[model samples]
Target: MTLTQHWKEIVNLVTQGQRSSMHCAIASVGDDGVPNITPVGTVFLRDDHTAYFFDSYTSQFAKNVKSNPNVCLMAVNTKRSFWFSSFLKGKFSSAPGVRLYGTVGELREATEEEKSAVHQRIKPLSWTKGSKLLWSDFTQVRDISLTDFRPVQYPKMMEHLWN
Candidate 1:
């Protein structure tokens, strides 16, 4: 199926994962040819096929992306209730996880609109003292052009659905 066809499902899965865990894992290859994975909480999906993440605390990941733009982002719905219900029913009502393969664009200053959106997303944590220190200074972002989407499937758990 085309990427656009699955865009809505992918976005839903990603949003669920973000709400559950507050971050997604981004994988890239380092200069030593080793795989690097970083948990990034500032990632935001602009649309079905495009996303961007603030480049505040991703020094290693940024370096890896600069050398090899190819990257994969994985998000999982880790809510206890969702997992328990799915396992009990022996099927997932929706995808449990999703992987997005894409190429990273150059890092540039985040626009005012982007900053405002990010602030709104993290407003729940604004009461914490560390929120200011951690979320501030997100002046730059790296855009990702999603090229592929893969849903995590458990054959035994949802064989009938796939069939």
Candidate 2:
């Protein structure tokens, strides 16, 4: 489906996934042609059909993207309440997961505005000891130009959910 048309839903799903799981898996091809997956928690989507993530603490991911820009990001809703309700209803009300396919752009220093926004996004965790350690020192970001979107599907469980 077109990203422009589904951007809102995609954003909502990603937000929910973030709340439930705290991170998304980004898959990229390594220099040896093997697939590598990294869990990134600082990803954020802009109004445009693009997403950005902090590049700190991801040396392998950065290297992989340099060699091959193509990547896939997957987010899953892992909240216990969501799963319990879905199980009780015998189907999921919404998609359980989503996959975004895109090409990652070169890493660059984050602007002051971008840094501020990132701080605001994680402000709730400011009191935690690990917050500073984990969120600080992020200087670079890689822009992902989303080109495709796919919903994770369970055929048997979803057969009657939509109707």
Identify the candidate with maximal TM-score.
1
Which lDDT values do the candidates have, in the order given?
0.88, 0.87
Q: Alpha carbon lDDT of residue 151, candidate 1?
A: 85
lDDT of 1 by residue, 100-139 (tens): 9999999999999999988998999898889988986778
Clashes of each: 0, 0
Q: Please provide TM-scores, in order, for all candidate models, with all chains considered together.
A: 0.95, 0.92
lDDT score at residue 69, model 1, on the 0-100 scale: 97
Q: Cα-based RMSD of the predictions, in order? A: 1.4, 1.8
Candidate 2 segments whose C-alpha is farther than 4 A from its true place: 159-163
Task: Estimate, for each residue in 27-137, the C-alpha lDDT of model 2 and write its tens digit.
Answer: 999989989899998889988889999888777888898879999999999999998999998888888888999999998999888898788878999778899888867
Model 1 misplacement above 4 A: 160-163
